[model samples]
Target: MKFEKNTALDFVLNDLFEHYRQHVVAVDRITSALLEAGVVASQADIVNDHIAFRTLGVAHMGIASFEKIFLAHGYRKMDHYHFAAKKLNAYWFKPPSPNYPRIFVSELIVSELSDAAKGVIHRYTDAIVADPVDSLNLGDGQQIADFLQRPLWELPTSQDYNKLLEESEYAAWVIFNRYYLNHYTISIHELKEGYNTLEEFNAFVEGLGIKLNTAGGKIKTSGDRLLRQSSTVSAWNNALFADGITLQIAGSYVEFAERSVLPEFRNIPKSQLSPQQRRDGFEADNADKIFESTYTAQIKDKG
Candidate 1:
């Protein structure tokens, strides 16, 4: 499907370009570091050539913009797969180098969208070619570097440089996953009685192909032990959710609950606290303290 180059699309394109530029810079930095460290004794030209060969096959704005539009239409991303190119002897056979990281495209599997929504998507695509950027000439690395330097934010910092390589690699995989896979599942159930084991509730989610542990799951409850114990149990009624979707839901829900629910408790002074309430509150506060200490320790270790 084609989409017109509207202002919104242009904004998306700019962001995609900046993202790609940052990724390229990060890769170059890592390669430079490795070369200096004697890990790779190759000349800068060879390294640059390798990077160009790897990334040249990737479409900058076109494929990226299409993936974004597809996501907006409620299509989930899928898993990414990569294959290595084979090396051949110089005389007999020279296998074609793959020239880039194995490229993956996001698919809009029809099950997630309504007919009306699909119609809207089709109309949107008819206005412009999905591959407009394919026809546009992109400049080489030096040109990209000049453009990137124009924006102060585009310059990499020591912290950013340290993290960018790892983050960009992960981000690429994440984008691929969101475009191609069913990363989340939603299940609706009627409450018959009160409640049973968390495992039973989670089993329903698992049956739908959602995995809580993989995505990081949590149970919401007013009860202290119920909350702590639910988190403790390896197998419980915890509904499983996957990475891209479930983490978003859990993060937003927790943040919302903290903002909305905690304020009411502040109205009651410490003097009015019931014995159990005081104990529970104390334990919760202590848990937070411990967590902070451990987190600080880990950060120090990393440094």
Candidate 2:
């Protein structure tokens, strides 16, 4: 935990993350399962590498609107990344101290998508004539917590949902689950024997019958190879549409990240290394497939 000692801010972030875990059913399930299976003794021993969020790339919403909550809590925005294939622009923010998890927020470029995809997204977001986050009080932890799960628009029709899914699984996901927590990563490198590295952890997880996103490969590695990541294919939940029709839709999943020693820090013992000596931020190519952790191609395999 690199978080600076700030009780007030720590409480607020914990409250928000707790609220999120309650809604993201997979979080509770996976964590419990891991503990029950004796992978780790307790939750405190594991570190959350980071958490992710997806946003619509339209007016009155997006990284611009969403980042305020974290920035207000002492997070400083770090690297900016572009995803040409997914039409996303993202940035990762570091915590004031090592205790808090890093934050990654990405917004879709709706204008770059096709008219059909645009129309489906607009149906939900066009109603937000004003930037809602602007009117909210960031100091109020509960308010910010509610805002994360609040529905910005009415539920989309199954048809529109499918249309967006066809064009962009990310679009379909954000449309139904607005401002939802995409996934929280497990810092696998910090774990004990048989789970310290991604390869071992991945094998151990598969032995438990959990499916992983194999889009590029079971492991998505940085070009520098200091950061390796993988995730369970997001579990499908039955979405209750406005029309009362129930259909299985992809929900959030758990991610595993193993950050290796940086080249310059090779001589130092990992325990004695500084935070900067570790792989600091994300890699675009690796994330490209990690993003597919919730796509139709990936979800179909889960089903």
Candidate 3:
């Protein structure tokens, strides 16, 4: 997401990203490494493939409600994706301009969870009788930015959090960290020669001592083999629960994606190729694994 911070949308997006970068240690570590390695002079030099968020599929919330923020900013809703095993639904939004990163928003199918998990979720979200975004003045970027960070529900107790974690990690995540940026993808193909492929980039990142998510593998490739991606394992941070108890819970992570140019566009010169020439939308299989970047299993496995 390259921005000069000149428009309301720019300011709002930058504000949200700044907040995310501060908490997600991997974001800066990767950015600083890129700077020192001369890959980019600053963060803006990296092309953000997209930014993602997690939500709960409950009343007055979820994709229908959360998407209004970006929709109001002139984004157009695109393809829909479903992760059956994960019991999740998502949609990717195309940015109004090429300069902004695409938006990917996903929501957990709360009804599909066990009754105990549903009860724990409702206990926290039943209060949201109306869509929160509806009350906001969407034109006010700062207002929108603040709303994204605001607490929509009370914090969950460790007992409730763990219960949800057992059934659905996505539920556990949203219960505590509502509307926070899940992960921001760095466009790997947009980087210089040596770092443009996931194979080389993964080695670069791993050399920095960063752990990569090995849910499916270090690199999750689409069936067409055009879209390959890898993400860092989430770092645990102290999270305060409702009962004044804190636990080391998984937080946000950073993602790297390599979207190869389409076959139809193979003849185009490298300098003339545009984003549209590359593999566009996301794959359900690839995303299903990427979602596990924060799972305990991924974080615990040393091998």
Candidate 4:
């Protein structure tokens, strides 16, 4: 846990964002486009609704280990969600203050995976039998900062990656891109112009030649219609494997979100729909589709 009384909440977020954008290339392109779209007055005006991370359910890692950092910073765990088809368990946290972004973490259920897939995954993850994060000084800013981007295992061969890709795309992704920031969602309702609603904003994104996840039809709305969300397909990157081979795989991407006023608050003026008035939790049906953003649509092993 962070020991300092004045640990500077903003400093932690700023540090995370700086490191995040460096690896998630979509952040740069989309933020720039948002500014150009006049949806925001400036880069500073853009609001991140949340950021998501993917993890494995094996020992020494997963949500239990990752949530400690946030809990230390005053964030509280909120809703818990499970995706049976995806074989994942996840939870979203609310920041101590409204200024910080929410955190969504999902861990794959390794025990449910095919033995072949599990074996290939453990071949690499076994390198860190102990949770590396547990050894770090919780009070150290640099150590907490490094945890997010640090590599936990050696690269797998292209063949193993392809095999994992066949059974569980999430396993392939986590194995190749460990603990990387998966995607950051923009609060489109907070925008000033061109992309205010998820619908229009999605059209605007497609206009820029960015592809959206159509698994559940570009716009995934909550059953109550209080939350609307959309995201671009992940960018493909050429990754090097342990066997001296390179393969193009899906990387991180950007997400757009618009939270309509809850039905109970519908009568209130638009200005009255404050941060809390708008829906604050995620939709399992919506997230189930959003998770597919990381899968290569072709399904064939391009490698």
Residue-by-residue lDDT tens digits, candidate 3, 1-303: 556777778978898899999999989899999999999988989999999999999999999999999999899999999999999999999999887899999999999988999999999999999999999998888899899999999978999999999999889988999999999999999999999999999999998889999988999999999999999989998999988899999999999999999999999998999998999989888999999999999988784
Model 1 ranges with Cα > 4 A deviation? 1-25, 42-95, 98-102, 114-124, 129-303
- Report the C-alpha lDDT of model 2 over 1-303, residue by residue, as the tens digit: 222324556655566566667766656666676798787776666688998999988998899988888888789999999999899999999988786789999989999999978987887888999888888888776687677778899988888888898888888899898887888888887776777888888887777678889988999988888999999888778899887788899888889999988887899976786666788899988888999998878877743
Candidate 1 lDDT tens digits, 1-303: 011234333333333334433432322343354356554453221211000001111223223443333243233444332221110000011112211111123223222334543343333334443344334223233332333223211222233222322323222222222221111111111111221234443443334333233112233333343222111111111122322221111110000011011433656764563322321111232122211211212223321
Question: What TM-score would each prediction reach against the true structure?
Answer: 0.22, 0.92, 0.98, 0.91
| Model 4, position 223: C-alpha lDDT score | 92
- For model 3, what is the C-alpha lDDT against the true structure? 0.92
In candidate 3, how many Å is residue 204 off?
Answer: 0.3
On TM-score, the stronger of 1 and 4 is 4
Worst 10 residues of 2 by lDDT: 1-10
Using TM-score as the measure, name the better of candidate 1 and candidate 2.
2
Root-mean-square deviation (CA) per prediction: 25.3, 2.5, 0.9, 3.5
What's the lDDT for all of these models? 0.25, 0.82, 0.92, 0.81
Ranking by TM-score: 3, 2, 4, 1
CA shift of 75, model 1, Å: 27
Backbone clashes for every candidate come to 11, 8, 1, 0
Q: What is the lDDT of residue 48 in candidate 3?
A: 92
